[model samples]
Structure formats: C-alpha cells, structure tokens
Target chain A: MSSTTLDPSRRGAHAGTGGAPAGGMSGTSTGPGPSFFRVLNSEFIKFRTLLSTLILLGCTVLVVVGFGALSAWGTGQFAEAAATDPQAAAAFAAQGGDLAVGVPTSGIAFAQLILGSLGVLLMSSEFTTGMARSTFAAVPKRIPAYAAKLLVVMVTAFVLTAASVYLAGLMALPILDNYNLNLDLASPQSVKMLLVNSLYVAAVAAIGMALGSLIRNSAGGIMSLVGLFFVAPIAFQLIPGDFFVEARKYLPGNTVEPMTAVQHVPDTLEAWQAAMVLGAWVVIPVVLAAVLLKKRDV
Target chain B: MIEARGLTKVYGDKTAVAGVNFTVEAGRVTGFLGPNGAGKSTTMRMIMGLDRPTSGTVTVNGSPFARHAAPLRDVGALLDAKAVHTSRSAYNHLLAMAATHSIPKKRVHDVIEMTGLADVAKKKVGGFSLGMGQRLGIAAALLGDPQTVILDEPVNGLDPEGVVWVRNLVKYLASEGRTVFLSSHLMSEMAVTADHLIVIGRGRIIADAPIQDIITGKGQIRTRVRTDQPDRLMHLLAGDGVSVELQENELLEVTGLDPRRIARAALDSHVMIYELTPLQASLEEAYMELTKDEVEYHSLITTGAAAPVQSGGN
Candidate 1:
C-alpha cells in the first residue's frame, strides 16, 4: 500500500507502508507555515504526555469538589446558628447572607494557585530540561509556539475550572439539602460566579506562563507567580499607605471581585475596568516574556 | 551544502567561535574535531539558528536556516543529547517534534526502530540510560529525513554496538547525498567515520582539509629502513626538514620522506636494504599536534585541577 504519489512533486521509492516517501513530503507549500493550528497540536502533545501534568490536572478537580462539599456543610451550620442566635443573625446580615452563590467556587483561590503552578511548570520545564532546542528548532517563528502554548494553558484552565466548579455545585446540592438550605444552580448570581472564577483562573494560568518564560527556572518562575498573585496583595495591605492601597487594585487576584459583582460594589473597580485590568495583567507580562524569548538564545 | 562566512559568536567578553569560513559539501561525513571549549557546539547552534551570531552568517543550501521554508527538512541537529523533556516518554518526545512538521506517526515509529529505541520507546526519558538517551536524540534528528544532519558527539555514551550502528547510519546517509556533519574528540572514531575533517581550536579553525590530507599534512608518514649501511642510507636520504632516527642496530625511522625515495636512494647507492617498512601516523598523535598551542593539551602532571585525560595513546 505504498507509493500512491498524491503530488507528482514527491515521487520516489517509498520508505514506509504509505505513499509518502521517507523524504518525500517537504515543508508545507505556503500560507502560515507554523500556523497556530499546527503549533497548538504540537503543544497539546507536549502537554498531555507528561505524568506531572496529568497529576496536576487530577489535583485541580479533586480540590475544587472537595472544597465545595466542605463549604456547603459549613454554610448549612452557619444558617442553623443564625436562626437560634440574634447576634449571629446580625453578623450574617452585615456580611450579606448571600454566601451560597460563592460556595461552588470556594476553592477557586487554591485552584488558581495549583493550576497557575502547572502553567509555570509546563513552560519552565521545557527550558530547565533542555526541551526548548527541539521546540524552537521546529518553530523558528518563536512567537507562534508561545502563543499556541498560552492558548493551550488558558483554554485548559478555563474548561477544567469551569467543569469542576459545575460538578462541585451539583455535589453541594445534595449536601446542602440535608440542612433544608436552598441553592439554585440556575440562579443568575451562581452562574456569574462560576464563569467569572473560571475566567479568573485561566488568566492566572496565563500570567504563570509569562513568568515561566521570563524566568526559565521552574522554582524561580513559580515563586514569581506566587509572589505576584499571592504575596503582593497581602504585602501591600500590611504596608500602610495610600499608594499601596491604590496599587492593590492593579494586582491580578483583586480584579476577580470587581468583575463578578451583581451591582457596582464600592471601593472596587467597575466591571469593565476590572476586565481591562485583568486583561492587562495577562497581556503585559506575556508580551514582554515572548519578546525576550524570541531575542535570547535557547 | 552548508556554508559559513565569518561565522562568529561572542558570549560577553569571551568569544566562543571566531570569524571563520568553511563549506561542507554534500555526500560526505565532515568530522568537526576539537577539544572541550573549542566552539564546536556553539558553531553548530549558530548554524541551526538557535544562537544568533555576533557577526557574519551561515547558510544551509543557499539560505539562512531560519529563512528556510522548512528548516527541519533542510537541516536536522542534535546539539545535545539532554535536549529533551525528561518527563515525557521517548515515543512522545519524537511525536511532539514530528507533529510540528506534520510528519506522520509511521515515520516516528520507523525512526524509533532505526535508532534501536523500539523497546524503551514507551518508557519515560528520565529513567533512560545514557545510551538510550542518545538513541532518542538521534531518532528525533532523523524524524524529518533531513538533507543536512548535524550530530554533536553522537556516540558520546553509546555501547559499542550502538556506536557501530550510528557510524554505519551516518556513512550510509552521506552516501545518499545528504550532508552529515558530526563532532567528536575521539580521533580514532573520526579517522574511520569522516571523509573530510574540519579541525577547530579555541574558537578558531585549525585545519579544513580532507581526512587523508589532514592525516598526511599534520601527521607524518614515515618509513622504517633496515640496512647494514644505515649511516650512509640515513645521510643519503637526509634533506631539509627530514629527520632519521635510529631505532635499533640496523633499523632507521625516516620522516619528511616516503618509501619510494628511500628505495630509489638505496638502489642508486647500492646499499643492502633488508626491509623498507612504512609507518602510518595514528590520528590521535596528529590531532594532538594540530591543536598543540591552539588548544592546551596538558602534560600529565599530578597537580590535578582537572586531570589531563590521556586518550587512546595512553
């Protein structure tokens, strides 16, 4: 079943069971050589093959669901206490007893940390393990490979986070029902929370990738990512100043609340403003990293 | 064909490869010979477009490697055997590389088989022995069936059988009109595998000549002449740049002259010559001579900042 000769350009004694000779099919004819599609395919293969990647993916799902069930039981107990105690009821009112909407995404902060670390590991491992030479060799148009990897990471983060959130919501329904608590999965606020948190996790993953590219060492990249999303906000708060207070708005983790609100929340960015700020958080570092990666030797 | 015009690389204050020019014609194995820090890998990296040159340019088949429509098809390079993700299986590593050029899975399998990695193809590369890792690197290089192949120390950690396989494979590839350029410090390996030699030292090319020419030019081909009239024969054969060393009572080792001249001198003078034996120079000694001052061939002093390796000649 060899030597069918699809294009007359590559006619020779075939080297395999198919028509394509060993050296028959050369480079693609024209139009987007290392196209996004091709690079994406390559990146996907790289992503799925590693045991560490699969382990991280599995951890993301388990944490989201496990935390969701825990939050559900905790919320039910709090609701029961509010009924018996007046002071507890007042505190619950002050906090706005709308805690159910966020229960499904209770583990999102942890999810972001884990999934973001996965993103950092993926890109940094390539350099630390010396895989960049093979990667860059295939796609010398370096940006395409970077873009494809970013696309893969962000999309995986979005899909996995969203699905896990939904599954967590479903699991919580049964647990919350035991305490006669009502949780509407179809509620507008609930849907908004799931979508916004998923998008937030995806953006965090992209930022992680940018850090990995900028710093090719895995420990350095993950530490930088954690420093940006985890440490910076707390550090800013601990330092008492108007500048630190104002600068905290620009931090990537804080943007999720402003963009996910039911109404324009005071002392927080507007929805559109938060969206733009989050976009900048992902784009600015990613672009800088990409430019440096292209210019520097592997 | 691969051509470099003043291909240079400088890392901060130290230059790894200086401005030098050479062309590797197709259909032969060009052995890049040098000691460590001789810029063989740096030059190969620049040629593959992984490292940008500080000055000058190199082209494969009349265009810079990055500019080629399909760079992998034009040239394949294994700069380092560690140039792989350890977490991935050997099969998947090749598969990921193959996917970039739309190379099929069948070709990947064929390359795996060709490199004798079929057994460990499914295992994680992190767990592989050094020999297995080298096979995987070779497999990745051959995935595209490239015209110009560059393998840096391809046999560095191979078993003897694996070494023979690679030697035969590169020679076979060269015979089919592909340009196969490889680098090694083993002069014995280079002597047999290369048709041409490009010797580099301290970021500069020392000699660029055919294999035979290098062995002849830098290496002396001497003759052992056994005769009762050794002194007369030695005097008769003596000329400018020629040296005659008496090994035994009757044996004389003649340099800067060949067997034909010695036979002619003996016939003309009517000296009774019992034996005229030609002694071929080993490539190891020749390589040492070629890189004498250009690269430090350290003496066997026990001071040992780094032990000076006495290769096969030891």
Candidate 2:
C-alpha cells in the first residue's frame, strides 16, 4: 500500500489553462475531464447508489399498483349499481362511457408525492450531508452537475412512473374483465393518459429538485414541495374568489388534469395552456436554482 | 503550485480570512499552521473553489480551480473528512467521484487499497471512524493522481502509525515534484514533516518561511542554572541585556546570555553551581511565541483559588 501505486504518468502538455506553467512542475493532465456526459454518468451513479432512494422508488410502485387494483374493484361496483338504476346509468354515461381507462392512473396522486419527494431529497441531501463539497469540486462550473442531476431525476421519474402505471394496468386487467368492461391498454386514450401522466410526474420531480436546490434542506424542500402540490390546491379550492379559482387552475397539480383530460373540462385551462403552465413551473425554479448554485459558495 | 492574491473571506461581521497573499510552490511540503478560527480551512476551501472568495483570487496550476479542465487531476483536495454522503459505501463514493473525471475503476480500487480501506470498502461511510473517514478522504484525493494535493488536518484523528505514514506520504509526494499543502495545529508534526511552513493567526499570515528558520528565528538564547546560593548568582549574573528569574530555592532561568558566561560568573562569585544548561527553542515554544497575541480564544489558567482545597478539618 505505497503511494507509488497512486501516481499516474505525467504528460508535459497542459490541457485546460493557457497560463504559464509553474516552475519545476510543468506537467499537466492529459486524461479525460468532466464533460457533460461524464457528469451525467456520475450523477446517475449517485442516484442509483442510495438505499433510501431505492426504497422510495419501490414504495411508489407498490402504492400505484395497489391502488390500481382497488380502483378496479370500486369501478366495477359502481358499474353494477349503474346497471340497476337509470339515473346512475346516466351519470356513468356522462363520464365518457369509459370508467376503466382512469382506473390504472387512480394512484397517480400518491406517486407524485413520493417521487417528488425523492427528487427533493436527491439535491438537498448533497447539502445536508456535505457531499456538495465533493460534487462541486469535481465539476467546479456547478451548473453541469445541477443539470445532470435534474436530467437524472426527471428521466427516472418518467420511466419509473410510466412502468409503474403500465404494471398497474396489467394488474387491473382481470379485475376489469370480471365486470365485462373493456380496457384496451393500447388504445389512443389510454396511451395518451400514460404518456401525459408520466410527463406530468417528471415535471413534478423537476420542480421538487429545484425546490431542493433552493432550500438545501430535506425537510424544508419536501415541505415546500408538498405545500405547492398538495396544500395550495386545497387551500385555493376552499377560498371563495374568482382569482383563487383561476390561480388554482394554474397550480402544477391541477395542470395535469387539464392536459390528460379526454375533452376540455369546464373550469380547467386549455391543454396547451396547461402544458405551458407546467413548463413554467419547472423552468422558473430550475433556472433560479442553477443561478443561485453558481453564485453561492458550497 | 497554488497561489493566492488578496484573498479574503468575510462572514457577516466576522472575517474568517483577511486579505493575504502567498504561493505554495511545487516540489515541497508546505505546512499551514493556525489556531482554531484562524482560517486555514477557509483558505483551502477558496483554493478548492468550494468557497467563493469575498475579494480576490486563488489559482492552481496558473488558473482558478474552477477553470481547470480536469480539476481532480490538476488539484486533488481533502478539505474535510465529512465531505461525503454517509449512506453510500466507500467504494461507491469513490466510484462516483471518479466517474466525473472518467477515471477508471482500477484507479479507485488502487486508492482504496493504498489507504488501507480494502477491508471496509463495502461498508457505509456513516459507520467509519474518524480515522477511517480521513483515509477515505485521502483515497478520494488521490483518485485522479492529482499533481497538487491540498489537505486540511490530514493527520488529525490518525494513530501514531497512521501519523508516521502520512508524514512519509507527504514527503514522498513532494519528492515527485508535486505540490503538497497540508494544514495542522500540531507544530511538532509540522516541524518534522514540512519543508516550508506558513503560520496564520487571527486571520492573517504571521510567519511564512522555511521550517528551520521559523523555529530558530524569534527565540532568544537562555540558560538554566542551579546553585547553592541562587540569590547570589542571580544578583551577580544580572547585567545589561540579561534578565534572570529565580525559578525555585536554588534554580534560576537566565535569558539573553550563554551558558559559559553564566558558569564564569558563578565560578567568580563562588556560587557553587552544579547545573548550567543551554536551552534551544523548540518548534512548540516558537509557535507559542509567534501566536501568543494572535490567538483568538484564550483559555484562562487560574492559579489562585481555582485549585482544589485540602480538607483539614477531617
């Protein structure tokens, strides 16, 4: 265990800087540095190595699939009651005659909460545990690491949510079949619901990561995330002004409903408007967090 | 090589590191010595680009650290032992840090073994002792075989053997023409391990010179004398530019005079002196004198009533 094994062969060429080499130590590294792809790889490694992060991902799958099964049974019971009553049948028909399409996504609300908090923890833990010093030291520009982590968080959120939703749909197939209801998982409406919901979850995760970077505390970041996605929606609903109602429609949580709706809901914004609003929700905080991260000392 | 110009860091109303300039040259082990809160860590962080300097600039290899193409390769630093996520395995933490520079997995394994972490590489970092954490930090710093190494308090929690290993390791690194800058409060360790020393006190550079020069520069010559007539020797040896203090009944500490002069005076005065010893200043004493006024926090040594009382009534 001698330091001789630690030495790498030095090259005389200096790679990055143009300044005159210091005397007697003219050698500089010629090996690979922190490119964008390398930083992305590093961030992905960090993302996958945490047991707590894996536990959160596992919890999301269980909650989503488990709720999908429960929703299937409940929707079956509702259809049975509609068969016995004309008024109930009319109400069911008003639901676009497709109660089963929404069954697979019934647990999306909880999925957002779990995965969003995961996003927040990913960034905030870097500060809480003092890993930010190592992280920023490796990529001193700072923005590349932030961008890389954001990409990892959002992509993982989308892929995991999409897979969980699909698995939940698979888990619900027999239950829906028992009620003689048809749910074509490959249908246009179903596909749109899956893709849109996954994208929406990814957007929520980006917002959570941004909040994490800005707050730099796991508890505070997660609380702010919950306040934005959960409490604000409810609080806005309970208030009685048109401004509150209009603002509620623009809340990130509410934007998903409008974008994923089969048709325009009465009180919701247009699908494009919801998409833009969601983009703003992610971009504003993310840009601000990047700016602050660059400016502040680790 | 690392250089700083007008480097300053101010936190609220307190300044951690005042504006100072110095260069850590290559091919030598430069020791940064400072008391607590004297800003050794702050200066290192600024050099590592972890902390933004309030005023000026610090550069490694002729440019700022953030400007380096491969910073890990150009300048590896162990700023703190806790600069790692506790939940991750030691191997995985190094792997992730290495992945940033596209360093190979073999290099990671090599550092792990080199730092004596082969046995606990799979364990979570949270479970590591302070010494183990330090080893991991050193392992990470060597992950890229960096040219300039900056370590703050590298020998802090190490055992005696580990301390010796660090001493040899820094000297070895410097011998390879690599710049090694380490900070420690142990002046004795600095006296032996470093070739050049930088002493900072009260957020300012108080002494920056060769280690030998710092040890011998400010200390005055002194002699200890023991005699039968201590008062007679004290009065007889008293002269211009000489100060004598009676230490005990027959022992005296005479400063600013050589031991021969004290002996000649004692012989001439028939003082019956049995002990005449010349005392050279140790690095510890020199450091105490250098930082005596610059120490930010002083521990009061109460000599009168703070002593435990003897129970005589029993």
Candidate 3:
C-alpha cells in the first residue's frame, strides 16, 4: 500500500464538497457531502419517480372530485326537500343556508386514508425492498434522509390535497348551479375549509410516514394508522363510558372538524385545542420515528 | 483505507461477529473469504455504519463513516445486490442515490455506461436477472467515484463473462490506488482477484495474509504414489508426520511427508513406484484447511457415504 495515497488531509479537502478538479472522471472528486438540501432533492426525486406514488396522488384527485359532484347533487336534493318541511328548513337555516360549500371537501375522509397510506408506504418500502441500505450509505447520519423524506411526503400531500380540493370545488360549481344552489368559491369559509383540511391531511400523512419508519412494514404501519384515525375512535365511542367519549373527541380524524369549523361546535374541542392535539399527533410519532431510524440498523 | 479495532456485533445471544481487528489498506484488492453465516457481511455493514457495532469502532480514512463530510465521495459500497427498490428503474435508482451527494447527471450516465447497463438502464429493476442486478449494484457503488470501494458477493450470480468483468473492474480500481475490499465465498475467485486474503469463519478471523502465502502455508504437503506394492509402501511410510491412504488398488496418497523422504523410504524398501507426483495445493484446498474446523453448518453423512471431494487442486 502506498502511504501517500492514504493521505487523509488531501482526501478530506476534496470529500463531500462536489467541487472536483478538472477531469473529475479520473476519480479526483471534490464533491460536497450530503447536505440537508441535497438529501431533500434526492428525496423529491424518489417521490416523483415511483409509479405507485403517482397513482395514489391521481386516485386522491379522482375520489375527491367524484365525491364532490355526488355530494353537490345530494345537497341540492336535500335543500329542495327542506323547502316544504319546517324542521328541515330550520336545520338548513342553522347552517347559514350555505351547505353547498361543504361539497368540495366531501371526499376528505377517503383522501386522508389514501394519502396517509402513501405516507406509510414511502418509508416502509425502504426497509422492505432493502433500499434503506443504499440511502443510509450515502447519508450515514440517517436522520437527514429521514427528515428529507418526511418533508417530501408532507409537502406533496399538502399540495396534492389542496389542489384536489380546489378541483372538487370547481367540479361542484356547475352541478350546484343546475340544482339552483350557490357555492361561492372565493368565500372566506371556502378558503378556510381548503387550507385547514389540506393541512390536516398533510398532518395525517406525516403521521403515517412516522408510523412507517417506526414499524418498518407497510401493512403494519397502515393498520396502525387506520386504528388511530378510524377504528380507535369508533371503538372508543362504542365502549360506552365518559372516558371513551372524551378520548374519541381527541382522535386525529375528529380534530379536522374543529379545525375547519368557523365556530367550535358543542361537545367538541375548540379550534386552538384541536390544532394542538393534531400537532402533538404529528410531533410525537415523527420524533419517535426519527430517533429509531438513527439508532437502528438499516 | 478502512480500519477496525475490536469490532463486534451480537444479535441477541448470537455473536455474528466477534471482536476482530484488521486494516484494509489502499492500492490493492483485499478479499474477505468466508462461508455462509460468517461475519463477512456483518463486518462490512459495520464499516459502512449501516449497523451500529455492539462494541468497538471502525473508521474510514480517519473517522467513522457517518462522520465523513462527503461519505459517498470517500466510500461507496454494494452491500447487497438487492439494495434497491425493484419498482424503480435502474436510471432512477442511481439518480436518487446521486442526488444525495449532489452528483451530476453526467456522472450517473457515466456509471451506467461503465457497468454496461446502457441497454437495460431504463427498465425496472424488478425484472432484472441476478447478473443484471449485480451490475446495477456495481453501478451504484461507483456512482461517487469514491476513493474506497466495497463489494459483497459481487459476482454471485454472474455468467463467466460477467465474472471476468468484475474481476477486471476491481483490479483496475486497485491499480488506480483505490482501496478495494470485496467478499466472496469462492476461494478460486479470491485467489485470482485479491492481493491479500482475510479468511473468516464462524464469526472469527481464521487467517489474514497475502493470497500466495495462504495457498502455500497451511496446506499440508501431499504426493500421489502409484506402486506395485501399495500396502508395503503404506507400512514403510507410516510415521509421526506421514499418513498414507490406499486410494485404489495400486495408488496411495501420502500427506505430511515430502516426496524426497518418500523416495528414500521406497528405495530402502525396494518397492518400485511407477508414479510419484507432488500435488500442488490450490487456494480452495488451503481455504478448506483453514476453515475445516470453523464451518458453522456441518452436513451429516452416513459412514458409507462418499467423502466430500476437495476442488481447485492440480
């Protein structure tokens, strides 16, 4: 072995910087190490390249838009019935006669499930397919890659959900017009629904990804996500106890209503309390996942 | 260069790798030869910082792998052929890995071409044959043009031509003063490809030396003898350092004694031997000699069953 060739000073100077001397093809690299930005860029590439992830995103759009049109027609029929029924009319009036505004986000329940599963899949697949080895090898710090992937999953979930919700609203417009019902797309309430619901779904996706990293299996992660967001709430409600009822109100899925509601409904958490609850839901799992990822073997 | 000091890994009660220390220096291809269940892969994973050591430390250059400012540029590894998402195309897999280090598209394409994956680069890795997967792995390992390259079972599922290609590639990398450490269970492959050999078995280091020394050092001297009076010669050659076995009616295989001593014994006994051939021990025999006692899985055979044939001898 050549002593000069093993010189750490010379090698360290060029390592991770990405700035190599001329003819870098000769293995004379001056490349930059895996910075947070670089890892983020890599994660984005991974996110956009998979056909399955793209398909999930497309499904979210279709389901949201399809459910929007259906809900618009359903709301119009109910509004028509309320014209003659006094009790129905009183209930309709209590909603400020703006029930059509809720049509666009009718598919949100399904959106949360699909996008949340997508979140779980992206992280869990790394372990299942052994890709984590390559990923961690490049960024041996491990957490940078985890953070970068989380950013990609959450951002994509937010943008895709928001865009799908907007498209659903647009699709609901003509349907509602045919039924002689009004839906103001630019209304403050409409914008609040769009932004808050989008953010909520993004939070669910983050939680799903955290479960994925922690569980490191697709079915297990998705199942745990469903239990937290779906089954646990229903199960808690059915158990018939004061504690069960109180706990059901704090479920992640239940938090969305309070966050998007203009006024806090009775028996539900206030918007600020709901927001903190949702934040805790996301923060706890994500932090746990990050710590485990850093410590475990790839 | 890579260095390990008392590196160990224990999975529950099973010690996958005991505390073993060794250095893989630059400018040569060092082969890590071991059987299945040995610590080869576990040790390599520790060096890459993928698996935390239960105890001790390993370093690349002068620090832990995770501490390297530019880990990809400093070290690249093909720890497994399947260290990829099968649904992703070869091009995209390499692209994602390159993105971490801010590597250019040109470099990604360069590695693809270098690994002869240009034709299948766009196809999903799920459909790739094992050889193709190995090629893609090599492509990823070389994506950074790293100073140190580590490959585990690199030619595991390759055709003869692919095997030759990998052998030449590792040698070329070493020739350029890069530290090339590769592991394989095939002693013949390591004999020709590696300048130095680190023989491991049952989670322990059995031997570490130059390749040539291993082939010649532990392997005992054996000579093939075809004589008219095989039984008489067997009795004449019976001694502390010599054991004679009747291979056939007229053929006797002798071990532990050189041919000169055998010839002297035969001359004194006046037992004419038609053939006296010295058997040159190949790397395979030397490896078996070193690892025979350390193998983890021993196949049980009945007493009348045929003895295991030792390969790679001339």
Clashes of each: 0, 0, 9
TM-score of chain A of each: 0.89, 0.92, 0.88
State iRMS for model 2.
5.4
TM-score chain B for all models: 0.77, 0.75, 0.76
The DockQ value obtained for model 2 is 0.32
Q: How does model 1 fare in lDDT? A: 0.83
Taking all chains together, the TM-score of candidate 1 against the true structure is 0.85
**Residue ranges of candidate 1 with Cα displaced over 4 Å:** A1-33, B218-286, B289-314
> Residue B202 error for model 2, in Å?
1.7
* Residue B149, model 1: Cα distance from true site in angstroms: 0.9
Candidate 2 colliding pairs: none
Docking class of 1: acceptable
Q: Kindly list the per-residue Cα lDDT of model 1 for residues B88-157, writing each as its tens digit.
A: 9999999888788777788888888888888999998999888888888888887777767899999988
Structure candidate 3, residue pairs in collision: A16-A31, A16-A32, A16-A33, A17-A31, A17-A32, A18-A30, A18-A31, A18-A32, A19-A30
iRMSD, per candidate, in listed order: 7.2, 5.4, 8.6
Instruction: Please compute DockQ, using alpha carbons, for every candidate against the native two-chain complex.
Output: 0.25, 0.32, 0.32
